[model samples]
Target chain A: MTGVTISGVGITPFESDAERSALELATAASEDALDDAACSLEAVDSVHVGNVLTEALDVQGGLANAFVSAVGLEGVRADRIENTSASGASATHRGVEAVASGASDVAVVVGVEKMSDADTSTVTDAISKLTHGREYVQGITLPSFGGLAAGAYLDRYDAPREALAEVAVKNHENAVDNDIAQFQKEVSVEDALDSPVVADPLRLYDCCPMTDGAAAVVLERESDAEGVHVRSIGSATGTHAVAERPDPIEIESVSRASERTFADANLSRNDVDVACIHDAFTVLELLELEEIGFFERGTAWEATMRGETARDGAFPVNPGGGLKARGHPLGATGLSQVVELVWQLRGDLRGDRQVAGAETGFAVNVAGFGNNSVCTLLEAP
Target chain B: MTRGTRDADGLRVDEAFRCGDCENEWYYTRNRCPDCQSATFSTYRLREGELVAYTTVNVTPPDVRSANVLGLAAFGDVRLIAQMSDDDPEVGDSVRFAGQYELREGGEKRARLTGVDGDG
Candidate 1:
């Protein structure tokens, strides 16, 4: 196992109507995390901020230094990491390295995104531009990729369309128990099917909403303190052009990262009790599960349809509602997933939502529709 | 026709590069071959391909048309992402590069594909 231990975690509510600036949100989450770890500002040796689109949308820069001053931390190393949607996990990787290498005694990583004030068109345009320049000019958005992949997957496997909607239905139900979820309410299969179509064969419910939030975690060398151990983190990058892949449904980034992570940690799939997958779209949840070796190719959809991934199922997935329900604030989503897993491993979750005997948790955060991905494994102390 | 000096937008919609070392072809222009790391390349134009997958996008960016259709087409060993001039193209259908059109506001004219009749 890695020498890094997660001492504390904190997350602000995921909301669409953000009333606070990104700096304020980040400061608040950092304060909560430091408080949880009983870590004083003077003890933090480094701070890494995971953020994207804030400077573009809010026209603000030096976010790391800004957060350092806001939290009253001085003489600590600080910087920002940007990797599209996987920025949080990348920052966490840096934090873990700092402590694992004895560069710092304690490190705090905060990821924040505030885009509620921006107009919908501006946000959509910015996100769409994440694709390759050629594809962007062709007007291909992330949801379009989801729709294309979903259609191909269904036709190739002869899977029922209801399987896709079932993912949305289940995630929405899970969100009902998640107070911090953006859409903390249940949605029926019929409701999902009837929802407005954003991309063909993928309804509005199939996609994650644009959210504003921040999540933070404090890391230190493994100690006797009550915390979760950072087992390992694996990352990989695939073809930049989505169309260039030989197989449209194959997410090389997820599979490669998962393989490396499991192998590096000397762990097996059976060891993971719960998972927080990047379900930016419902189709992605099934695709990633298969890619991660949790289920066979062309079979995760059926498993999902049979309720095998529910909170009470043998293999629980997205126990914290997932991005489809919890919300996706781009940069903050990866760290939020870790926060959820940390809480689950620590048995901090309330009734019904907690995995009864959860000791190991897995999380995968993807960037730019699987152009790159970072997989994280956390174990109970 | 090979015009190595032309910019992406100025080049033909079907324009692409082939590595001299590995013969790897791709749509995006790169100084060196991604597969063989060869600096030598030749330009080529793709006129036909097979539709691999497609989607009808209803929630589009502000600059794009509503209900814009996009598709991934396979040309020999290469793949290209382009707009679909026709909405009813099926996967595996033989498609031809129809031409180019402005798919987004303030964007360069990009390629468009259409299903060729009598070809699956």
Candidate 2:
């Protein structure tokens, strides 16, 4: 079992830059990553990009190659990897494997998505296709499914509504110093609580915004790398559709992936210094925390409300503000998590948002109601 | 629609192919007994089971406004996803089929299941 090392990482500012196309953003991020690693396009052997609905968004086919060529990486093996919203992590996993297996000395992974240009309903309709098409024909959107899961969580665990609100407040506070985040201003708890409801038990603020952004990471085998070590990588899949699951909050796939990664790294939950669990929805963070074994079942809300997961709390979770405040460009989200982890591990982050003494970190990417999941463990060099 | 035979419990039961020698019965859909690799099978309407998993569709098809609850039920080792009639169902709750219900206007149909009597 050879180890893979992440030599460098990069990200585009997650904001409404309607003037620039998705490929332009991707090129910028890719160049940043390559430059940070002190490597050039000639040194890279493969390129992996993640974009959820590039075709649906009227982007040309072979978009990955198009972006790579624009970034002056033509003649390199390039391909797109999509797995619902978790496309970024899926692509990263592919790139890591390429390096670890000696198929390539260096591989670059990029995630980009432009979601704000499309109509909300159209975006919702497109995302719904990730579920059972027959089910989507019934008009089930992500928000609807999220609401159902939130309701179940609230009912079964007696999860407090206020605790969920706390998640938004904490993330927003952390985002205040994140210049690249979509929402840089903090909001009061009352503002979060009073926001319009998108789905029952979930307000507008509780959900991540429809953001447009890109993120990239450069990976090289440990023997050829000059950076942080990829201690372990694990992925798992569960029921295909959310309706097929026994409990939405259980997230069996995520739990399995986390357990496998921990075992592979020969570390326990207590060893993780920081974590970035997918917070597509605020409640998702709570469920992920519990499912990842950070806290006991039915206690994530309590842990959150008690400030256990705050930026300066006992265990800093989502110091990058997570998808909730940092903005969620579906394709870029998983890669964005990796970028934050790399920066934290390297002590490169500026301002008040840095996680103190962070050495080992974990990132969990859940796709389509935990149907597909990937977990990665990172350690400082 | 052809009316299926009803069992002693008054639940509708449809006949399906079953290996006479294997004595294996399956209800919804299958070409053969997956267990023994026998191309033979029999059908019996599911009588009793428990909800294995469930989720509600808040944004339903154009025809429906209220959330539609759905779940998978297990009768012995056989499991299938079906429309749930109960408002809130917990995993392991007993369930019984309530016959077929119209799922869509274009002849789409599905059998409905509810919590067992006195088990709700």
Candidate 3:
């Protein structure tokens, strides 16, 4: 089996106050990645741009073609992916497939989001539309789902809010070394528990902040590759409305996608060295770990409490911090996850933050409250 | 609500349609069955169910003056997303509707989930 290899990865600093436009952020990352790959714009055959709510947030559309034109890479086959938060991973998967299918020799995938330009209320309303407007989300906010889900998990697992606070504390501590991370200061469990209630049982610290940034990955055939080989990319879709599912606690799409990716790569859960499960909400991290088969059901919090997910633990998760501290710019988040995995697999992380002797790395990018999922597996040579 | 829009004032009724072939039921309006892609459907009423999940949104849209408590209520095989009347709704608490909560005139009017008669 053969898959495209990542030759270069680039990212803009994830922050809440990035003044740059979406196009500017994307072009900068694309150019940086091409430079890192030692390739020219002329060598690129296709462009994939991942963006969410650009038209609503930035008043822009036709993102892919416009990006190629602005970056002086016109006439390349270009496409835009809009799978909400998973847009970046979706675009990367498409880029990898393009090279693997012989449609392009070299492809560039850029995920960007410029959300700081809008008001907080506007941003909140925009995200709510991700669910069914008429029935589920017109008046309801996105964090409402987090609050409801967290409350249920606590009752079902016999866990307390302190368990969720540990995730915020750990990720915040990990972000101290990540220069581009939005929050570099470490927080204590008390600070998280005492934070103002955004939704009952879920404090402000439990949610990922709105962010602005971009990241890029360049994929080429392995014969001309210079980085980690994408062992497999698997995707699956669940019921559109989260409540419609029989089991609200389990995300069937993530499990199915993870299983397919591991199967395609001929690997098992035990073989994975580093993993990045989406942590838009602290409770989501615990559930994703369980749903992805990294841990037994209702036991991920114990692992986190035991320091098993730390950078030096048995299997480090989100060593460069997660969406919790990394800042989630929706579209850019998926690519940022891939960028971190590439760094970990290449031993590019510094200090103890870097995992030792990492051989296999994995990541999952979820979209629109687990309605869709894209799981990618990378192998180190 | 246009022509053929039926209403039951006594009980909260959501017009649902089930696929005649696959028995896939949905509360909202849809052209085809998501499962079997069947066009033919039988319309029915969804009256009452239990709360699957809920939350109180402290920060809401500007139009929503007070904190909006929302709920995901299950009626048979389908779930309805709506503004819930119960200030503190348990996961499995029975929820029925007393009246429509169309607070805004032109805004979207979704279903309302309220504590049933017997359940507190």
Candidate 4:
């Protein structure tokens, strides 16, 4: 099988709100990625758009076709991939598969979401529907899941409430240097803990804000491209209902996906130099780290409190601020993680945020409450 | 395990399903058993269960109450998520199904759990 390489990656400034349409943001990011690759639009054989809310929130459809038209690309195979919040990574995986299978020599993967135009309640209600139909009727929002999990984690492990706050503190601190991050300011643990309660035990700072943005990556069939190799991608599905899982705090999907990713790449967790995890909620960073084998169960909070996952720590995670601070534009988040990994592996970032001597990187993007997950491994060129 | 044969009320969230083949119990509605893929299944009412986790949802949907409490309760081997009548409930606390109520505007009437006496 032919290997695939990320020739270029680009992203729009993740903002709490954006004035542009999803299609416009997607086109701009795709153009930037194409330019970064030094490849013309004509060289692109396929376009994969990762998006979820445009139709529901923006009242727009046919985003892929519209993006291709906006970019003046003709007759290229266009497809839209939507896996809820994991849509971006799913699109990246799809584009890489196209290039790896020789179905397309050059593929563009873009993830975009426009959420600011909608009402706050509308956005929350729409996101709430991502859960099982039965659970949706119970009015369980995503933050409720975080709050429940945080409560359970704290009680079960006897972890300090400050441990959860530490995640936001570290990620926000890292975002201070990320120019495209939505919140480019450090938040102290006190600030996080004092934030208004969105759900019991989970203050506002623990949750990712609704964001609008786009990110794109160019995948090329193996060549002399000076880019990071798309080593492999693994995906898995868990119980649809969060309550159905035997252990509410255990994200089996992430564990299974990471297991498959490592096994397929013939590597171990120790091989990962840096990681961009799906920290949609502050507690998620710790839970996912443990699930991905970076830390032991119930000990992730202890490790997090010790700053082991900080940018300068032994197992650096989310140096680009992750979803908590970098902004979670739903579909764009997964691709944004890959974009950060590409930059890290290329050593193109500034000294402050760079993961030094990074040769391998891993990223995991999860759907609602770990209903599904997609994990990718990237190796330096 | 037949698909789409149940009446509207038959699909209520309060009902739990048991696989005849593997004897596995689940809360969600599915045609086949997740464990054994058996089409033979029976439905039972979720009357009482132990709370595995609970949260007071301060931020609810527009139609729901502001400080809605929710919990994941286990009925035998089946687990279901429902709104809690108790303001605060701890893990391992006994909770019984209170009744059905609309948790959201235009939403279905879902089951609600309340902590047993002095258990919350």
How well is each residue in A125-146 modelled by candidate 1, as lDDT tens digits?
A: 7777677766766778899999
Model 2 lDDT, residue A169, Cα: 94
lDDT of each: 0.88, 0.79, 0.84, 0.88
Q: For model 2, report DockQ.
A: 0.13
| Model 4 docking tier (incorrect/acceptable/medium/high) | medium
Candidate 2: tens digits of C-alpha lDDT, residues A1-381: 348889999899998544679998899899999999999888998999998987877666787879878998767888999888889999998998888888988999999999976777677757766765334433456766666667778878877788888999999888889878999989877898899776667788888888899999999988877777888888999766565455556788999999998998899999999999899888899889999999999898998988999978998999988999898998999999999999999999766678888999999988887879999999987
lDDT of 2 at A359: 97
For residues A1-381, what per-residue lDDT tens digits would candidate 3 score against the true structure? 356889998999999989888899999999988887888899999999999988877668898988998999968999899998899999999998899999999999999998887999898867777775343333656677777788878888999789999999989888889988999999999999999888777889999999999999999999887788999998999877677677767888899899999999998999999988899989999999999989999999999999999888887888888999999999999999999988888888777878899989999999977889999999874
Error of 4 at A337 (Å): 0.6
CAPRI band for model 2: incorrect
Flag regions of model 3 displaced more than 4 Å. A136-138, B1-13, B21-24, B103-111, B118-120
Better of 3 and 4 by lDDT: 4
List TM-scores for all candidates, in order: 0.96, 0.83, 0.94, 0.96
Per-residue lDDT of A343 in model 4: 94
lDDT per residue as tens, model 4, A1-381: 238899999999999879888888998898889988998888999999999887777578888888899989999999899999999999998998898888999999999998896999998978887776667667889999998889889998999889989999999999999999999999988898899998879999999988999999999976746688988998999888888787878999999999999998998999999999999998898889999998889998988888888999988999999999999999999999999999999999988789988999999999999999999999998
Q: What digit string (tens of lDDT, one per residue) describes model 4 on residues B1-120?
A: 111232243576677888899888888777899999999999877777899988888888888888989888888888888888788677899888766677776555665788877533
Q: 3 or 4, which is superior by DockQ?
A: 4
Residue ranges of candidate 4 with Cα displaced over 4 Å: B1-9, B106-110, B118-120
Model 3 per-residue lDDT at B84:
72
Q: What is candidate 4's DockQ?
A: 0.60
| Complex DockQ per candidate | 0.60, 0.13, 0.45, 0.60
